[model samples]
Target: MKINFSSKTKILLYFSVALILGFSIINTVSFFYIKSYIDKNLSKDVEIFKRIYMYEDQSKLIPYLKIVDSNQNINQNDIVGKVDGKYIVVDKGKVYTELIHFIISISLWEIFILFIILIIANHLVQITIDKEKELKGILEVFILALTHKIKNFLGIQRVNIEILKINFNEKALMRLEKAYMLMEKDFEILIQALKSLREFRDKREEIDLKTVLEEIIKELESIYPEKSIFIKLSSFKVKADRTDVKNIFFVILENAFKYSEKRIFITDSMEKNIYTIKVLNDISFQEKGSGVGLEIAKFLANKYNWEIFNQSSDDEYIVYIKIPKK
Candidate 1:
């Protein structure tokens, strides 16, 4: 049978196993040490008692006195003592019991200390694992975002290069210049994204959705001049981080143009306290993508309590982003 254990459970299991093994080892070592201690002391006590019985008065050590001659048979409970070439039996149960109790007490205290150390070690390990996981997630997201942005900029540069190859005129030169400027803009956006990621809970301000959409549309037109685009947006306002909002729009629109046919449509409306924007494009249903852009967009939307929905048919793909007017 397979037992599934979560991270916390696994850590606890490791600690428990270590504790049990440690306790067993300590107990075994303590038992041997205690046995040796008892044997050594008992021998010393027997020798001392033997000397006392031989040379001193009989009444002096009555409590420890247990004398038996060579002819007298010793029972199971009797400890043998030799004095002056003769044998005597003595009872050592009281002293043995006292030593056993002391050793057990010391062992329990040591185990308690070991238990505390294990608990602290487990806690530290858990914290380290959590931080590592968080760092890994951040790195993955950063790499995906960076790669997507670079690919988009490169596509524009490739197009300009193609134009230059066909005709080396003012218009081609201007297109090249535009590509370079877009590259610079892409770099700036990346820097701003990194800064925003560091301070993800930045203060929100009233954002003009209409203005943001117009700017994105213009940018897309410059990159894909051959593609037909339509936009119909009414005035809408939302409280959000400006960079986050811009990045969301950019990623969605860029994806739409990249994956769609020659046409794309965008529309927006505001009703009551909610504003919704929808983007629709034509694409083959079988086409698949890494979907990093949409993932990032949805992440940002969820972070700001906005709602995002996606729908796709055999020939049409649509996304709706709904934000609360604040």
Candidate 2:
């Protein structure tokens, strides 16, 4: 069987491995430094004591001398003064063991503290990276679905237009014109969909939400000459990147056009530091297709962490979006 990991899982795994490896390397290096420092200092102490006893005053050597007897036992606090040139060398293990234990314990704790700090930093970076990857994945999928739906709808329009072209009588010509108009309207909707998809897929900067909606409304007027689109704006903004927001608006407007039998009512609200845009139209349940529009809108909404609510009654269809103000 084949296994696939989500981007978040991959990031966590990579972070864990890096965190562990980094701490391990640091601990190893710290141990090595301690070992070298201990070895060098021990040798230096032995050399200094040897020189003092052999050439300097042995009477003063008592204070600096830590003697080890032949049984390999050392007395760290013992005072043994010698005359002019005597040596203080014993072979004992007890004093040496105690000194080694003290140094190792202190060095081990230092290494532990450093490793802990590095691990914490790694975890924080991992969390940020995982969040970004998760958002990227969702956006990619949503855009892909949008593209698929646009193409499918466009293809249907093309077939309908071609059928209309083959009929050329006076009465047929009138019906052909209506079919051509529908095909043209579908193309306009595709353009709106593409506009939204491009913004997200290309990672555009922040856009004026009001301006984008106005543009969508302007285009809708031309597309549906038989239907009216009304807008009521109240100074609200979406805390979404430009491209994502454009796609979101495009999807909403497209739904309005698809469902509205006569008129579409659109309005915005900004209250309690939150922005809400509502688009309402009348629709028939029989008008539902493969549900591509709703699906694409939902997919992209999740990508941006936006809340989407849909409500429909026998006489009306409504879409409400709540956008947080950053």
- Among these predicted structures, which one has the highest TM-score? 2
Error of 2 at 47 (Å): 5.4
RMSD of each: 8.5, 6.3
> Over the stretch 289-323, how does candidate 2's per-residue lDDT look in tens digits?
45556666676677667788889788898999887
Instruction: Give a tens-digit lDDT track for model 1, residues 222-312.
Output: 8777778988888877788899889788878877876787889999877887888999998844345578778777866776889888899
lDDT of each: 0.76, 0.64
Per-residue lDDT value at 249 in model 2: 76
Q: Give the backbone clash total of model 1.
A: 0
Runs in model 1 lying further than 4 Å from the true structure: 54-65, 68-73, 83-87, 90-92, 166-326
**Which candidate tops lDDT?**
1
Give the clashing pairs for model 1.
Answer: none
